[model samples]
Structures are given as C-alpha cells and as structure tokens.
Target: MTAGLRALRRRILTPALSSTSLEVRGFRKKNPTAQELLETVGRSFLEGYGRIVEAPDSQAAEPRLEAIPREFRGFAYEGAAMACSIMDALPGSGGRRLSGLLAGRGGAHTYMAYVGIGWAMARLPRMLHPDTEDTDPLLRWLILDGYGFHQAYFHTDRYVRGQHRERKLPWPEDQASYAHRAVDQGIGRALWFVGGTDVDAVLALVDAFPPARRGDLFSGVGLAATYAGGAGADELLRLREGVGAYRPQLLQGSAFAAEAREHAGLTVPHTHLATEVLCGMKPHEAAGVCREQRPGASDRVDMPAYETWRQGIAGALVSEGRS
Candidate 1:
C-alpha cells in the first residue's frame, strides 16, 4: 500500500481517542484513578492499532509497539494483533499479516494476540472471518473471549446491561455451542471495566446472569482484575470473597492472567497482588499451575482441550485448598 493509502486506512480504521473515555462509554467512574487507568489502556490499544495500520507489515510495527510502557505494552501488542488480523481478512490481502506477527515478538503476547483476533472477528463480515483451524486448539477460544469483550465494551446495553447472549456462534465448526461459554468469559472480563473495578457492582452484574454462566463470567473477572490492576488489595479481597462457589473459576482466570503476563514479561505489581489474594499464591506460582495443567495431545471428543485446560487449573486450585 502507498503511504497516502496507509494514512487513509489508518484514519478510517482507528477509533477516536474519546471512545475510551468513561463518559463516552457510560461506564461507571468509581474513581479518577480507575477511570484514568482504564482509559489509558484504551489509548494504548489504539496506538498499537494505528502503528500497525501505518506500517508496511506486522514486523515493521514492532518498535512502536515496544515503545509502549511496560504496564500497557501488552495491550498495544493486542491492538497490533487485531489490526494485523483485520488486514489479513481483507480481500486479496494474502492473509499473512497475523501469522507474521505471531512469529515475532508478538509470540510472547500470544494470549492477548488471540484475543485481538476476536476483536477482528467482531468487525469483519462472517465471510471474511479468519480461519482459526490452525490456531492453537486450546487458546483459540480466547478469540471468542475477545469477541465477547468487544461486544460488551462497545454495545454495553445489549451485552452487559441487557444480559444478552449469542444463540449459536458460526465459527469453530462442531463446537459452536461452546463458543457462548468462551464469550461469557470475555463478558466477565469486560464487567471489570464496565463496573470500574467496583467489586460490588461487578458482583451484582454477574449475579444477574444465569447460574451456569456465572463460572465463566467470574473467570473473566479474575483475569481482568489480575491483568488490569485497577482494584487494590481491599477490592481484590472483596472480589475474592464475593465470587463464592465460583472461586475456583476465579482462581483459574487469575492464573491465566498471570501466565499471560509472565509469558509476555509484563508481570506488574498488581499482577502479583491479585494472584496472591485470589489464587493464594504469587503470580509465578499461579502461572506455574497453569503450565503444569496444560493438556498434552488429546483426542477427548467430549470437551475441547482449552476447556479441559481451564478445568484442570480450577481443579488444581480446589485440590490445593487455595482460597
């Protein structure tokens, strides 16, 4: 693409910075700190997206993404991954952009990258959705998680307030039913943002959902609480106590977040704090649980390895009596 065309694409594709504002999203502004932190995350994501849109290729966008502050860098990589996936899904685009990104520094941020692909899926038409057949069978569910987060973040009333749920997702053939569960996990993550790190508000929102859905939702909450860091010790403790029967799911999500941060070399103070409170261990220890529980080659037709992996983590938490 020519420079002028790249500029045009960047202009067309990038969302306005105000879109991240608490006022614009109508999300709760529990406090200035939480609001500012969440909005900064949105800005970082956009910066990464814009960088990729203007770059010649995903690899070319690396330096710009790396320049993002450590706390926000993973989110930028997510945005870059989202942009790359979107470009690959466009007609006659050769479909190599996302692959190239995952092959480089983006690999460390694989969890975020998969979520980014879900972001692309939300904007693209069904016909243009990138094939996930080659994606890691276990991690690919995060695409739906990302998709769920996008819908909840952008269409808050319908997905969060109205408690809407997709009937039958069309991707991941033969396992479409499981997609809703994964999406719920993303919605759960979004709830953390939507409620502005207010433990009570988030808990109330989750309680409104059906019983079967609460586990996945709480799992998302755990991931966001650990990864995002808006909630302090008191808030996290309340969150840990509030999850009730779903505590294991919450711990599983926390572990996943720890693993993602650990893998990306982005482990922050909040990461450690959240894991300590929610998982009864430090970030590395929680992440180690994730690594140990990861499933090997599995032909288990009853459940996807990804779900099996999640269950394994949750079960480990239970067995260890981690509260």
Candidate 2:
C-alpha cells in the first residue's frame, strides 16, 4: 500500500515540481523573510535532485539569510530535514554530501540538520549501533536518535566522532537525556520507522519509557503503524489492546503523518488512506481530523510543533496521566 501511495504521490507532485527547477542559493528576491528562507531549504532539496547533477556545487556565496528569530530557529532543521529526505532517496553516501552543504550554516542549523538525519534514517533504519535494540527504552530511543545524527556525518567526520561525543548526550549516563530538544522530538516519530511493529519488541521498548515519556513513545508507535500499511486490521487492533491507553498519542502521530502527506502535495486520498488502514479509526473521523489541521495551499508545515501540540482532548488525557 505504501509503495502504491509513493507511486501516486510522485505522479501528483511531479507536474507542479517539474515546472520549477530547484534554486538553492541565488534568491533573486530582495529581503527574503524568515519563512521564505526556511521554505527555500525544502524547495532546494527538491531542486537539488533536478540541478545538483548539472550545476556545479556553487562556491559562489549564497546571499545571507537574515537572522532566524530564536523561537523559530528550529525551523531551519525542519527545512534541512526535508532536504535530507531527498538526499536519502538518492544512491550512495548522500549524508556526506548533505553535511558539506550545511557546513556553512549557523551552529543551530548544523546541529538541527543532524536531527533531520535522524528523521531520514528512520525511513531506512540502518542500526549501526547494536546497543539500540537491546537497551532500555530511553537509551534505545537515544541510540536510535543518535544513530541518525551519527550517520549524517559518517562519511565526512567518521573519525572526528570522539571530538565532541559527550556534547551530543548532555547526561551521558541518563538514557532519557536528549542533550538537544530537536533530537528529543526527532526520536519518537523516527522510532516507528526504525523499529517496525514487532508487538513484543516494540512494546518492550515502549514500556521502558515509564509513564513520563510514553507520550513520545506512543507517537512513534502510531507513526510506524500508520506507515506500516501491512500492519492490517488485526495487528493494529492487537497493538491497541497492548497499548490502548495511549491511543491519543497514537492518533496524534497518525495526524502528523496525515499532515505531512498533504504537505508533500499528495491528495487527501494518499495521506488519509494509510491512516484509515492503520489507525482503525472511523474512516470519516480520521479523514476529518486529517483535514481539520491540514495546511492551506502552499503553507509550510511545522510538523514537529504540530505533533507537540496534539488534539486538545488527547493532550488533556495524556496530561491527566502526567499528574
């Protein structure tokens, strides 16, 4: 089902994508806004596929993007994450290529780009670190999250990993410590892609989160289930039974996926179909929620922020558990 959806998405997105060649550095527009600058990163990612082959890596200086307001700086990573997705689809060592391109950015941009790497790696889930699988839930997510960051620079900084290794984990001893908020958000959704839905294995790792961290864990589970189109009705139900108390988190993840699909420019059918299949929600209910917060045409989707703020009721239920 996912394969079919991918095919259809490419078809729908192609026409619009084809008309515009990707423009990375040279923004002819004078005084681009923060949102425009961020949006460029995603469009450049699309453009990179089209132009990178023909256009030599432009050593010519890119026009300076204005300072990203502190609150919205994380958006840089979100944009870079979109680029990483494009790079991952390409054959061979794209992470190295990505690192080089991002080298010139601000410190936050560079760090957040690794979180993007985590997001991309979730799609393919190369578990370079063995401990991630057997470790406690918090450690497991961190390792999984770290692996994505690690892979992004694997080709370029393979040996330099030790230089600032401790900085990556603020509390190296604490499994739950993210060291970086971007990584904390990046991990849970990513776990779904990286950790497939082996009910016992998945739940075991999830159970390790304790009640405090389960919301994030549940989001990952929901994302994996929705995209795991093969999860089937029975398996999804089985999953619900095992971790049903966190259904709100699961639906939030589903909505996140749904919003992303729409942002990818796929029609509602493409996005909501997977939700309908994996979420086991009433088709209309799922579709309604999907469209409820769907981005208006050409708007940027701050999915991380969206996922962080879930349906109020879901948030309330999960919050109640917190107290």
Best candidate according to TM-score = 1
Q: For candidate 2, lDDT tens digit of each residue in 71-178? A: 233333333433434443555634333444455442224333444444345344343211123222222233344343333223213212121223444223443243
List ranges where model 2 is wrong by over 4 Å: 1-185, 267-274, 277-308, 311-323
**Candidate 1, residues 107-132: lDDT per residue as tens digits?**
99999999999999998889988788
lDDT of each: 0.91, 0.40
TM-score for model 1?
Answer: 0.97
The lDDT of model 2 is 0.40
**What would the TM-scores of all predictions be?**
0.97, 0.42
Q: What lDDT is reached at residue 32 by model 2?
A: 33
> Candidate 2: deviation at residue 168, Å?
6.3
The alpha-carbon deviation from the true structure for residue 33 of candidate 2, after best TM-score superposition, in angstroms, is 45
Worst 10 residues of 2 by lDDT: 57-66
Given candidate 2, what's the lDDT at residue 58?
Answer: 17
Which residue pairs show collisions in model 1?
Answer: none
